[model samples]
Target: MVARRRRGAADADQYKPEAHSSDGAVVYVRVQEDGEFVITDDDGQPYDETELRVLRKYAGEGMRDMLQQACDRLNADLSALATVHCDTLSPRDKPAFQSRAFPEPEPQRNPLLQPTLWSRIWPPARRRLEEQNERRAEQYTRAFSEWEEAARAFNEQERQRREQETELVLTNLDAMANILEEHLGEIPWPRETSVSFDLGDDASTIAIDIELPEEDAFPDVEYTLAAKQPKVSVKKIAATRRRMLYRDYAHGVAMRVLGEIYHRLPTVQVALISAYVPTLDTGTGQPTENYLYSVLVTKSQWREINFKALANIEPPATLERFELRRKMTKTGVFKAIEPFDVEALANEVGI
Candidate 1:
């Protein structure tokens, strides 16, 4: 076996990129412009990184080929070592290692002395051997643990890099799609250019249609920005996430002021949703019995809509008592909602 390995080493020293892991595993990767080879040694050990010096006087092969050769040589070396050490080892007089599992030692012992002598020494010998073996095993275990942790961290870094790449690709795709849509709009649809929008209830689609009078209008129309601007983002995740641990959605605080009113408001559609309610979902646990409502609207654009004369939008579902505040005063208050809010009120009134 040793002779065979010697031949293998002679054959391997011919190649370039060569490195070995701590466990003696050889590694071969593409050779960089520099003689250094980049590799991972079992875990995150940077021993295999680029710019590593090659001690051997390599000759007669390309960098890649040489590195591969080195790996083969390393593996061969390790195999030889493994063979000589604790494995199906070569003949050695391991006096302390006398065991039925292994062949008899070279210097034969007296069969009678083996019994009495073994009986006397075996107990202490066995204890010492066991302790040594356990320590060795522990050392081996720690080595593997360190290797595993390093490898896991390395793999995670690679994963994050991949995700970033994927995100970049997706963003580029969206940009390209927008460009294409704008170009397509210039082709002129069979129908005239037109536009319509409607917001409806749950399970309802917001229908939007744009009409073009002629193909020429398509070139004049800036559709790309308009198309991309309408995107709605939705996020779905596990409800049991850490941040949601203390969450509680208030189910009932029934109340409704059918005709709440803010007189001559700036045409900005506003709803006075006053209620004595349980605290906000998470940590804030105050009851609404003592909170004021009338907050300004944000996150949406609406024309100057006076709450006065704006029709009260009764929820399609039942309202809890806490949400029900003083009834909106002024019967005229039922007519001042913004166009969109009016549309909503129309639906509510119809319901």
Candidate 2:
């Protein structure tokens, strides 16, 4: 900025330059990864917490006007230099500058590509926009035509369906009337005490459902029977299920089985599996001796155990302990330490 003043009757001028972000304290602006301007402190760390008031104070009002003035002045200087380039610098001083001040003159580009700003841009841009609009209009027209065609096709299908519905109703009418006649033909129309035909909502081609009045319209006894239907159906489904109730009840069962084979049965240890598979057994006197790989439980041996994890419930339920859990014998028959029916337990508990 330049200022004029009169001092001692002589005119004087003073100039001041604006401060930049990198002026002092190593404070500089950098573009962050998020594409926002970041003001870094002297230590090279990004500003942590900054107040808008402090920023506003630094980048005070009318800052845009100051920037605009700078740009305008820069443009004016560039314009003057531009005219110099056109009239004098293009063929004359450029050669001089290239020859003396700088050595290279490989046909440098025009200082800034031309018509200064707009003329170089308008022609190609306008042509491109026109072409784009033409393409868009053609696409829109084609889409509209396709949409209209589809709509017409759909409407024609609907019209055919309506005609088919009319024919179906007409064809079914006589049959329906005959059935009604068979059911109520003996009684005169007015003489019949109460005659009602089941009516239905608008139906599709594949289905017909009677729009019966709501359950509230029926007596309480009928509602009770309907309410029991779900429970009865669930009971029937539960009765058909074939699953051991105590299968998941035991903890560390896999570890127990591993311990039993590794610690109890010495020949069937982990390393001897292949040896056992290929060798003959002394007890059976055959390579393929019949052995019980697994035991099946009889209904009497099934134990009632709840294995719902303790951590899930409030305050946790006390874990129940039972001695000598009943198991199936080698014959698949059950030997129970205590007698109990396990299969019907879940239904009894409403689970």
Candidate 3:
């Protein structure tokens, strides 16, 4: 029977004509002009059945491991779309500062206090004890003064840092953008993605634009091992199922962005977020971007969502609760639409 070659085993001499016997013996079978099968090695000698069986067993095991790894990778990519969470920030609490403690000097004992009565009564010993005690006291005072100066300087520096952090959380637009970038950058996306942020004249409103991955970026096939042979079967993903996955991934990204903004920027009242993909314009025949969806999420409505139950929530259904603009077909295919203008939309909606 004909069998496919194992993946990554590219040595032509090793797998000339792929075949395996009923008892799991690895044999290279060639067809003659008379339609008869001949099992032979690279030098055309008859293959030893004992060696063939051993090779077949190990090849089967390797194929099973490879198949398992491929399945796990696909599952991880799919799960990444639905799992997004972040720690929230609070501006009311003061940043914690670690203060340095004062260093205490060890107590010194007078060497003149010997067990002998003469040594204790000696006048020179008494004078030496006094001098030693005075020097120890002076050294301790100097150390204490230095420690006080250092503590004051450290406290002042920490105070300025805390003030800067509080200001950024309250009203600094540039600082807010930087912080947002850092938070968003930390997300482990399945594909390459880029994002940009804009702050409106009103400090509480913000806009976000995301460059989504193209449709071709997703995996379009699944791998499985053959039941009887050490071979892999690659099956194409159905068109409808792929479309649904794309829609879910896109919506999931949108939901994650909204969640991060509300959690990280405590003062943001409204967010205008849009996602788009790079494409060639039909009319101009030039490279351009197509906006897939745009949404306006308000902080008040977002608060009602149960963040703890995010795993059970479907991203596309969750987005239906907001003011959204999208042109998706019944089969989950998206069409281009114009993105929202941050200030104008806010003023029109009285948000």
Candidate 4:
């Protein structure tokens, strides 16, 4: 039985094979051509032939079976990793919109006190004092009224801002599109990719169009050597062999965009993703032409799929729900595959 090599052990000899037993004992096993067995315990120290002979004499016959069983158990554990369930949910900070604080209005106070008895003795003085007090009271009342109006306006502005932040709006859709573009731009690709979101009147459904790099930007297959030997040439892969690789790449990109939209934006229920590659037109032989591939999937439908398990499946098999069209190419001529119409889907859903 084969076992993993033990770490941090001293080199006992240059010729013997070292191994660990099931009981955590490290030993070296050697077979002689004359049908003799040599075994020695390793105690992080070197042992001569005399010490080895003593160790072999004391070693139990049952130790070999024990080590074999341990190795079998380790292999069994490793093989179970393929279908193991994992929690892959990633937590992100919820988006927040803050409103600026409005300035507080100054206090409006009474400008006059009680009239004095001396002022009351003269009618003109008393009248003048009473008129001054009336004027001051009017100014105070007017100032209070202006402050109340300012407070009401501030409150209304805050209410509208809060609604814009939480509810869907066309202006907010532009902001969301900008965010999608910024995120897609960060992908490690040759071209600057972007995505635009168009929200419908229904609010739950969103149409997305993503710009993808040219197909030529991706290599068909990578060359590699079968063995690490001198003067060995690397194996060349056929173009047909790499077809699945390109399909899988496109599939992964679509899934990533879907995850970002449905999970990050909780308001979105159904997302229709259209990915297009800008390349030279085959018919006109002109640059800056597009070949598009589109898929429509609901958030509920995607949530039912096991993403981890689906990762191992072929792209076409995993993306069967999209009803994706197949591209056709023949002898340097290419035909574009039309995607499902987003407007028709919206109308069917009564959006």
Candidate 5:
């Protein structure tokens, strides 16, 4: 699958002079250097001049639709952070051996029971039949032996696979980490998000560090159709609103990581998640990461949440139920805070 774009650049690039039919039919179109619309058919031939006006009328409407779509995409991206879900991993059934049935033996005839003189004279026919039956028995025995060997090798491979699945289901630290890494990569986040995991002493606890998007990463502009032409009018998002969005985005990410770990690894009782963004240190002038929020989520407390109604749950409000550490103003302006020390906190909590 193609990765989703995190910025508004893709939308901006699509705001060109393109048109479609009023019935919502797709049209191949491009604007020439001379500022003329060139509408083409599936074969790339230009449409007749008589059909140009009808197609051209919907140009403004199409561009307006594109702008509205871009706005909708931005909203959906924000909502996705808090609505992340994972399917539980279960152990596979044990492998069963499939036995190959042996072939039936051919019937034999006796030369002495023959009533015809020709049959009595051709006694070699009975000998040939006996020899053929012997060869058939030998071939069946050899084939069955080969089949048994192949079945043994196949059963061994399946046994190993079943053992690995069982270990993962039981939440072995290494097995959980390996499978979790694979599952995390398959999530379709709007941004290119990356997370690292570590086992906390045992399988009961896991620590996660998530790379948060920058403050300006959230969409800061509202797009609309202009009054005059097939163009979009831009309105800047208020400073306070943008700040709130960034805060929710960070908190949502923290909750998402916690939820994923608890859901995928049922034996994991606790999770330590920290959300951070890349920044330059003011004093040292070196690149560094500034943590926005750290949270310690327990399975018991997490179960109280109505997972079925995640769409209505506000990430910031939901996080209040957990052990969270953050420095933010009432207006949602976040300040850099030190991430929680997972090992020390786990020891203190006696987990």
Candidate 6:
């Protein structure tokens, strides 16, 4: 057998979006562009642009993939939960009723032993044996009846439990969220993070808010040898290069989300995903935000595109079928887009 190697911390730390969770807790979403797509958490803090660099580091993957994974985990957990305790009922002790006849007093045993001690003893002893047998037969009959009753109750409980589980799967949104939370809770992270989901009417449409790390998290740096000495320094990246990377990352996140959602919830044709970055508005000392990326797409239209064929697709490329609103300036700042119209998207997808 080949030896298996253990994974290192760096390898284990590869970006994994938090599993989709539906606890009522707020989910803060910060996009990298302008302040267009910001969802405040329970803290009621406003968006801050200066903090954007920090917020981009821990951004999670789209909810669709997370949810799909959660569903798989839930199915496994439910399968385990669905198992009923087996009732190992031993077979009841059945009495074999055979004909038992008493000897006729042994014919006075050699006639000379008339009125001997054993003659009196044998008659009484036989009577006692007959009585003991009757008692035991009654006891066995009651034990069998008790065993049958227990078996019936066990079966009835198991049937009801199965029906309840089926209903939970069909209609319990809370249960789904809880399962997602449980699944996500297993991932490793340096800090505590939470996931929350919003469902449109009839689960037909969905929106997700994922908190992400700041811009500083992605360092543009390299290790080098200068003057025969090893050194590390920051690498200056071009605006276009950085822009492309940011856009690609955002798009990748969206595609991952959309793809996973389509896989598990094909019925939900419309989806809106927004990434938010926290930063401080240089002018105001308070925190602000940039809309890193957002996309609205329908499964019906997206279903046709072979995502794997294209080497690279930006966020705008996916919005060809519908309307989009975003602000971009020459200074490398991106403004947020207008609020997405779920109803319009839902209708467009013919949901």
Q: Number of the top candidate by TM-score?
A: 5
TM-score of predicted model 6? 0.42
Per-model TM-score, in order, reads 0.17, 0.19, 0.60, 0.45, 0.62, 0.42
- Name the better of 1 and 2 by lDDT: 1
The alpha-carbon deviation from the true structure for residue 49 of candidate 1, after best TM-score superposition, in angstroms, is: 43
Model 4, 200-295: lDDT tens digits are 554457776666545453443222222322111223335553443344444555665676565445555677776666677678878753545677
Displacement of the residue 151 alpha carbon in candidate 1, Å: 1.8
Q: After superposition, which runs of candidate 3 have C-alpha atoms over 4 Å from their true positions? A: 1-66, 81-167, 226-230, 348-351
Ranking by lDDT: 3, 5, 4, 6, 1, 2
Collision pairs in model 3: none
Q: RMSD per prediction, one decimal?
A: 32.0, 40.4, 17.0, 23.5, 13.4, 25.2
lDDT by residue (tens digit), candidate 6, 5-40: 111111112122242234433434332222123434
True-structure lDDT of candidate 3: 0.63
Query: What tens digits encode model 5's per-residue C-alpha lDDT throughout 1-351?
Result: 111111111122332333457776555654432233445655677767666566656554664554445444435544453344322222222322223333333333323332355545677876665576677777767777777777677767666545644554464566666556655766666555667777755766777778877777776665454566644455677988778877766676666666656656666777788878888989999999988888887777777877666667778887778888888897787888888896655753444
Q: lDDT tens string, model 1, 286-329?
A: 43222212122211211222223222322211222222223222
Could you say which candidate leads in lDDT? Answer: 3
CA lDDT, every model vs. true structure: 0.27, 0.26, 0.63, 0.51, 0.61, 0.42
Question: Model 2: clashing residue pairs?
Answer: none
Count clashing residue pairs per candidate: 41, 0, 0, 0, 0, 49
Cα lDDT tens digits, model 3, 1-351, are 111111111111222444444555454554332223345554677757776566556554543444444444444454554343222222212223233343444334333332345536897876776677677677767777777687777767657545544566567766566556656777666667677777665557778888888877766765554676544455687888777777877887777777767766667788888899998989999999999999888887788777767767777777789888999986679999998886554663345
The runs of at least 3 residues in candidate 2 whose Cα sits more than 4 Å from the true structure, single-residue gaps closed, are 1-121, 172-237, 240-351
User: Model 4 residue 133 lDDT?
Assistant: 92
